[model samples]
Target: MTEILLIIPPFCYGDLSEAGPVYPSMGIVCVAATLEHAGYKVKIIDMFAEGYEESKLKSCLEDPELKIVGVSSVSATFKISLNILKYAKEKRPDTTTIIGGPHITILPDETMKETYIDYGVLGEGDNTAVELADLIIKNKGSPENIKGLCFRKDRTLIKTEKRQFIENLDELPFPAYHLLPMDKYRSYGVYDSGRKTTSMITSRGCPFKCIYCCSSELFGGRWRPMSAEKTIEFIKKLYDEYGIRHIYFQDDEFTVSHERAMKICDWIIDKKIGLTWECLTRVSHVDNELLSKMAKAGCKSILYGIETGYEEGLKQIKKGITLEQAKNAVRLTKKNGMIAKVSFILGFPWESKEEINKTIDFAIKLDADYSFFTILCPFPTTEVYEQIAKEGLFVPEFNMEMYSAMPAADSLIRTKYLTSEEIVQMMGHAYKRLYFRPKYLLKRMLSLRHFSELKRNFKAGLSVLRFTVKSMGKKAKLAKTT
Candidate 1:
């Protein structure tokens, strides 16, 4: 059996974004299970859990007989993956290196331009990865036969035909959670109370066409779901085996099928699985009745992407949810005694100062337990990215390092209506308006019905303050350079 190393790079935000304690890397676990099922010796090194530095990562790659290395990358961690790949190639010149995940899936050809990465996997990677491993084990380097793969041959890039999306999500095995360093992962809500927290995915893909979102493109526009019974069974297993009291559904849209969601909720309730969970949901898919049921079924929170408050800005992004609907959803969630986390984005090209103010005002009025605001980033392979590229709106000199932290004054894109500084200033103002209110603080303080909730909120607030001060300092430094 060949020794294959699957490395998940460190958490790239580095205290910039709220790190949310640490959890097992689901990507590596899924890939490991697929390879192990094929009789391969697989090992996963989750650097985020171990707090491994660059030197440590380099030392780990010193294994002389390692045959293959697979890395997973996201938007914020793409540069980290590149660095890891570069180091791995230098350390083991003969080892086959592969990169996959959202970043590479969206830009396969561009990713293949790097000599360090020998192959890039697109779309769902479990099957593609197993096939690639078998091919590598057989001493075959030809990538043309593999679907959803891009490689180089004789100094030219070659992309194979795209593969169809996986329709039967249930066919996939449960992630190889037992193979991970489980003790390293600690959740604020769990660790502080000596409880346990776990993360799981109930399904994949989103049906929405939000212009700024790439989930629909990455996981096909149609939603593929797991059986409710199977999902509940997994939840029960996590609770029984790992002593997990909290779970996060890490899905793009948890309520894609309301009927399935209700069925799952019923099963969880019927089984008396005493696990609290959170999930991301669309504003349009939620209702008072459904929210009530969810709260009863142990759902503690739901995160909503209310991109903008102005109708025009929402229309430009094709978010498909009205301002009224967003407000109603928040109210319903609160009415049902569950926490509502509202997510907003600022500095869209189509947004003016007036439009951004609308967002701030709406956020202040909605009064969710927590709010998150991010600058609009035009990621590669999205419609928004193409529009920005065509209009020459993107900063041509921007590199992946610039994405590590939140966009500073100098890093924000200049729009026709707002300068980069103006956008950055508006983001600061949005945070102040949404979070620095007496009512907001009071609501947050009073909402902590349990000691676990109180501790989680306190830690999260501290993290936010630390991030804000650091971001402000960085912005000031960037301003001086400019």
Candidate 2:
């Protein structure tokens, strides 16, 4: 029986994504680590990895010593998260229910209206989580003094002062990975080497203003990063303790600090940790020299968000990279013996069919080892979402279930010029043309070494075929209607 319980609600994508796309909830784990360092007992239940067994969940809720229940969620998964919190509130009305993450951080007032949620931590919850847990433990002190918190006062919503970002990330303890079901977590789609794999975040936030991105809102507009020494130490621990060979950095922009990245790579080489890693970053932040150093440090892959190929779409999104820059970045990544994984979006509300086609052609010309074609989703709290909502471009009764950029046929925001059906067809066509080529198939086959690699690749290939066939069927009906 612990004083606090941290829960991640199980979710289903409903044709949008795999039924259970499990990964460690780094947010909650970091909070748990803070609580542990502060001398508090904490328990975590990752419903996403554990399959959300009702009996097991009920057993966790039955702990008579439980004082606080914390739930973390993103924008799309907030509804499921709310439902789970509501259930917990019903079971133990006396226990305090707290919610945090991207959703609540973006719309604190709206989220606080949910009575089941007794409190919410606005952003970067490590410190605020400890504050809340301390309050519950002491059973004293008003929440009004706690910064970055939202709670009820006399049946009215009250928000506190904004919390400052942690300047030195080294001050925080390593994430409580021991509390997670490490064996059950897997992130496979488009991840070529997915055995004994886990994800890490070396830094937070981005300075660029890409309209479709919500990184700035979630991590604050400023870019704060952990020191190179701390990041390398964290990597060594993961490799030595968890036997994790492949690490995927989920930072908004890993290469934002070129000097820091270079130092980290050099340290990885000096220590000979023997772990291959991948990162996602803007094409503009990297150069040939950086790629060379990263390759020397066992960087096998680099994912670039080349959002669009057409200049007009690029301008609209403020991607800050020209077509030439993107091409050079991919070229450098491959030249340095790393796999270049590129991503593109098919539907911007202001984009035309001709422009979308040009973007698709550009992806083929780039000929990356892996490509992800997402239908542009105007997620809430994004520049694109605000623009689309103002222009009434979103589909009538648009639901969050289709908010995923994956699910080639799920289009919730359709431009006034193009119907939602057309966007879906275009997304499906992009994936089929990008992945089903003879050269692409041969390239992927040559890279395969183990059964796990073959299984993940085959599953991804089959997924592409299914999305294509479904969209093709929808296209015939759409053509008849026109």
Candidate 3:
């Protein structure tokens, strides 16, 4: 008989920047399902989709029966979450407010220090959230005993032991899509591939130990995937119910298991579900045969993190990929008639100017249908973060909010080898070099097979241009002040 509300805070980006359209937050959906299954009446307010202002958020929080309010956050949206929590307190001072997600998982103690948040649930929240809700309803549970949670006791922060990683991802129920406000979300494929889009995750966690990545710290070192049958069932339901033709597999690495991935693809083909999808993959996991099979099964595109062009720089970042593998992946994707998108990072601590140019050259050589470049960010809880901290290289004032808005260029934790300005310059150079080539422009123009593809590409290019100009202006203004 208890009522609960799950809120996803609004994200920034006044204008759609170079980054593509925003996807719905799946984490909240998962938590909502878990709570509902436990017999709690749950309502989800997705601010990103609904475009709610402070007044609207306050109205939702004003309910006297709202026993618990669960909010989700990431490093990019940490401040927004904090603001929502503060507003919740203003409306109902006694409400039990809980904060969970990536940011909280990494800095549980620091998050618990904020008086607005009653508890922080670290790691996967499906199980922990249900348990917390039950405890609040029964009035017999102590927050201190909850694993993967942090709370304050007698004005001191208390973090319980970390929760063990979920072993069988299949056990978690399908995300409560029915509970979400589906119409509020806009759907479009990444490259305008004529498919209305949705996002899915067949797996949790990544086994790779990339220094610049925080997935391992948050999801643990092991990879866990849902069974192929369960994965296909979700896809079938998505197609039949939502009329969703496009799916973005938001997995950290979708191709980690060869047999499992092939089996999933086989199921899709066998069922003739006709769903077009995209996913992030490692170069080493893919080859011509697998890519061909996936393309035949309705894979429109594949994104690979070819972090660097130079082998040494790749090694420096612990990307676990070779230049040959990256090149072959691109070639294979193209050969299989699928759009290949390669993502690159500029300004590793050990990278030199020559290495930066090599990365640019490599991206140009691959000539993937789409390419993305970002500056190296040493987010907290990663090996890169620890290394920068040990060497006194991290910007002391850097917090979650600043970390998110820090231009992909200026975001780099300043290294002993590369100045922040140098990194910013490299990011600009990488984009300009990869995108402005005459041959590349011609190829893109010729490859436009439909009006939607042309329009999406043009808009995406303009967004990148706007972002670059804005980033440059900010840099120039900062320099003048200094």
Candidate 4:
């Protein structure tokens, strides 16, 4: 019997397919750990990992001992998440429902309007979750005093004082990986090594002010990271117990502190853990020495968010890095024998067709091992979202359901010189220009050192081909309509 059930509502951005990647939510599991450490009976339902079934969810809600149902969500999954919680309230009228995540944190007032949701936990929910559980279990205190909590009182929304971000990350317990379907997610991301793979976040928050990102809103704008010792200990546990061989560091920027990152790498090397890892960071955060250290310590890939190639585009989005910096970072990453994966975003509201195409041209010139060209998705609470709203840039057909970075999908907003169809067409142009080149294909073929690389590359190639075909179909349909 579970006292509290934490759920991740099932969702896929483009379509549900067997080929889609599935992984556990680190946010929910971390909150679960805090609740368990506080002595509450907890269980996790990762409907995303194990496909969503209403019957299965109903059975969990039917538990007599289950008092609270907490659902986690992002903007893409928010609708389904609320539906799951509403179903919970319908099936078990006595149970309380709470919603939390970046989506709810950013738009608490709008989200709390849902009568099915009993409470909302804002940013960094670990401590607030435990407090809510303790309050519910003991049945004494008014939730009025609980920081980082939102509720309705007499039909007026009441959001308590914001909770402070956890300063000492080392004091927090490791995420409840035991409760997750770890094996289901093995070898799951794009940067896998054909070994048992899982994701980890040793830090939170980012200092950069990228307009399309809400990391600051979600993590309180402060970079908080666990000590190197703590990170290694967690890695060791995952290595020994779960036999995880590859880890994807899901930090907003893993190399925020160059020294801490190096120390963690050194510990991994000296301890001979032999675990391959990859991380996503900004182009400005790395240097030659750090790149060399990372490669020597079994780092196989480094993904940089080089969002646009135009110098003026960088300033417009507050990317805080230059084209030269991006080039040097990718160069050094490849120099140190690691895959240099870079990403670019198209469809900025101010960009003309020429400007967008120039960005794609810059991506090919960068000569990274992998290039991810995506249509810009202006998620709520992001500066880009606000700018679009203020400047009347959003397309009349902008739908939250279609808010995704996938190039195959129609863009949510349009630029001054392009429509939604044109943005997607540009995305197809970017993908084809960067991926189908003879030189790029030959380089990838020559770099294959392991069978795992071959398998992963094949899947990636097929996926790109499918998206390109879909984009062409859309283009043809648009031309006929015109």
Which number leads on TM-score?
A: 4
Candidate 1 structure quality by residue, lDDT tens digits, 361-471? 888878887777778887776788778777766566665456544343244365667666566667666775666678778867875557866767676667666655544
Better of 2 and 3 by lDDT: 2
**Candidate 4 lDDT over residue span 1-482, tens digit each:** 99999998886636213235566789999999999998888999888888788888889888999999999888778888888988999999899899999888988887898999999999989999988987887785779999999999999999999999999999999889988888767433445646787889899998877999888888877789999989999999999998999988889899999999999999888988778998899999999999999998999888899999999999999999999999999999999989898888998889877888789889988999888777887877788998888887788976554542343466778888777777787776677778899999998788777786687667767877776767765642333211
Q: On residues 57-144, what C-alpha lDDT tens digit does candidate 2 reach at each position? A: 6788899999888899886667778888898899999999999988788778778888889999998899998888878888556699
* Candidate 2 wrong stretches, greater than 4 Å: 11-22, 187-195, 399-409, 475-482
* TM-scores, all models, native as reference: 0.91, 0.93, 0.92, 0.93
Instruction: Quote the lDDT for 37 in model 3.
Output: 86
Which tens-of-lDDT digit does each residue in 1-482 have in candidate 3?
Answer: 33788888777553234346556799988899888888888888888777767776677776767889888998767887888888887788878899999888887766777898988999999889988987887775777777888888889888888888888888888788887766555433345355566688889998989998899888887789988888988888888888887788999889888888899899889888777788899999997789989998888788899988888888888888899999899999988988899988876666666777788888888888878887777778888778777887766776655754634536546656556666666666666667777888898889877787677768877766665665555442222110
Model 4's C-alpha root-mean-square deviation from the true structure amounts to 2.8
As a whole number from 0 to 100, the lDDT of residue 174 in candidate 2 is: 93
User: How good is model 1 by TM-score?
Assistant: 0.91
lDDT of 1: 0.77
Better of 3 and 4 by TM-score: 4
lDDT of 3: 0.78
Candidate 3 segments whose C-alpha is farther than 4 A from its true place: 13-18, 184-194, 399-401, 406-409, 472-482
In model 3, the clashing pairs are none
Of 3 and 4, the candidate ahead on lDDT is: 4
Q: Which candidate is the best by lDDT?
A: 4
